[model samples]
Target: MNVSLLANSLVGSEIIKIGNEVNEMKRKGAQISNLTIGDFDPSIYPIPDELKEAIVTAYNEHQTNYPPADGVLALRETVSGVLKSRYALEYNANEILVSGGSRPLIYATYLALIDPGDKVVYPAPSWNNNHYCVLSSANGVAVETSVENNFMPTGDQLKPHLKGATLLALCSPLNPTGTMFSAEQLLEICDLVLAENKSRSADEKPLYIMYDQIYSLLTFGKEHVNPISLRPELRDYVIYIDGISKALAATGVRVGWAFGPEVIISKMKSLLGHIGAWAPKAEQVAVAKYFRDEAQVDTFLKEFKGAVQKSLDTLYNGFQEMKKEGFNVDAVVPMGAIYLTLKIDYIGKTTPAGDLLKNSADLNFYLIHEAQTALVPFSAFGNDESVAWFRASVGGCSLEDVYAMLPKIKTALSKLK
Candidate 1:
């Protein structure tokens, strides 16, 4: 029999709908300009000479046997050092768990912290996984905060969800919206959790925090602030999740880590021991070396920052040009992260039965059939109730490609209106 509950609740992404439509149109001989990608574009950026050399050097030579269950010992130590270096927060190697990707690390943390019917707080327009992961695999509750407050959660705004939640899943430089809370605001939320925890006993439920900083270092003009930096004394309360996927553009490398209290990380590692166990021996060795050399890490950061900034600028200018051309676009320039969140409400729209069109999903479908463009709806990221919004992953597109897509974007938004 087919599985019921979480697995059954998992639906395919809404953006894929537009993408499949474009593919069908292309099959019918309609030319379509593609702007709907979420990963980095293929560019000829010089890969770190050392990492490349190491990959070749370490090939099959490393302990090719099943690596340690919690990941290679050396890699865990290196990740520990990285945590300390980045935020002056220290972690024992035992407190860090290696994972296939940040997604697994996130899912594993949810498994470790959450139980049936537990609530998990997330802001609207976040990484689609923030809620979907909880709902799809576990019997946890997904609570949505609005986009009106710039998508960052105020404690009061979040407390209702946080009330009985086993954990709070958060993303800085959020997914679709690319918004982040200030360092102080982050502490305020953490403080609220502590206060809330104080109201209960040690035997009572404790709400943990799974704070994702995968996009932490990729900020554009703004200071890339981290919450751990605010109050290192309370480190045990927060689980810091991150990986090389965003930093080194090594997404497929599938290397990520979870750093948190021994109790939480221990349980997560126990789960990983059964699920993914240690990372690939070679990749772990490579990432360990990559983390060890601070100079190399700094050099890589410098180059990546430049490339991502240029990409963000290209997106910024494209949206500005669209605004100038009379399209009502809400361009929230992300200071960091690899996406552009656009709200195109000016397009004239109506339902098929002639009812006025409403919400991002309606606009998304209109764009596909009429505009011949494919982009994910903001609702896919958990926005709801008539919020008309869209997101494009311009991480991989060139400035030229980004510019060329605007007319297509306008055409798509136009069809909906």
Candidate 2:
């Protein structure tokens, strides 16, 4: 049976495929330290007490009906207020659109702005920009990044591709790297985007930016920067994607938002409205109430950031120790997000059983067995499959879990000859 060409051509998530492999090992009673998925294990990191209680209360009050096409007005207003107070972003509620987590909002942004065959430029070793481009029939140009710049794409890397690109998909506290754009770094990119848009004719579609700042509040010491916040002039061309999934450790709650030019936002709301992807009404109501209490929000954030930081620090320090001990292992200083960029460059090395580690996927599987650990390789995020850099998500693990895996990693590396 033949299906639609788009359906047939769509590429599935490589991370999910690796996750399934980890699950199969776990089911067989393997003590696997699985760090493939970009989600929090609720047992390790639960949602805020105030927000959780509000969710229950809202349900009890029978707020389970269909939500407004755009979203409940109250939640939108709360989101606007939080952005204004925290980031100094002055978006009105009317410009905000709520959806189920950031995924739908991102997809809607692509569909709303990109026509078939348009170009979408994004940094590789980032998130799922490649798949989104495919879904929208846009030509995806992935700018490869290096560790010297903390795995972030620079203006020089992106300038050549900016000429005719319709969309520049960017994420800070970028998913796989756990690194963010410094103010000066992001300012340079913003300047480039501003110039590109300025060069476009009024009749032509201006180059737009889809800035994903979902992990903005999760930054350790570095400040999270956004395009509009850096260059207010680009506000009209920037669409922001953010939510509580990362900050609140509430991935399951499924409340996310996108705010930008009223024109693009209106079109996005229309697209998402037909798909009926509005966040659950009860969760939306609960989050709105949670946002209004500044003290409670700050307290929860303080505690939440501590837990996430502990795990990230454990991984970063552990890998550094290994690197100092002369192992072929290194990691980036985790600045933001729940990920640690791990470099285990063992390609062409021989494993204990004389099997050769040929690529990133091979290195991943070897660690799964030899060290009883699982990690998502950079190849999963649109990089070449042979790269050894991988993303270790700490959201699902505990401090003890990280420590226990350290010796296992050392022992496994020792076996490589």
Give the top-scoring candidate (lDDT).
Answer: 2
**Model 2: residues with Cα > 4 Å off, grouped in runs:** none
* Superposed Cα deviation of residue 263, candidate 2 (Å): 0.5
Model 1 off-target regions past 4 Å?
Answer: 22-33, 43-49, 60-62, 129-148, 346-358, 368-372, 411-417
Q: Put down candidate 2 lDDT per residue, 1-417, tens digits, no spaces.
A: 389889998888888888888889899999999888999999989999889999999999999999887888999999989998899999999899999998999999999999999999999988999989889999999999999999998999999999989999999989999999998888999999899988889999999999999999898989888898889999889999999899899999999999999999999999999999999999999999997777888898898888888998999999999999999899999999999999998988899798988899988999998899999999989899888899999898888999999999899989888
Model 1 poorest ten-residue lDDT run: 132-141
Q: Model 1, 1-417: lDDT tens per residue?
A: 389666766677766766687778889997655556566644633446787677666675754767787888898999888778876877889998888878777878877776665666666667755454545344444456655666677777777666656677778877776667777667788877877777778897787777888887777767655556776655667887888777777766778898888898889888878776456778888888877898888888887778767766776677788788877786776766777677777434674456455666666666655555566777777766366667766665566666666677676556442
**Structural similarity to truth (TM-score) of each candidate:** 0.89, 0.99
lDDT of 1: 0.71
- Top TM-score model: 2
How many residue pairs clash per model? 5, 0
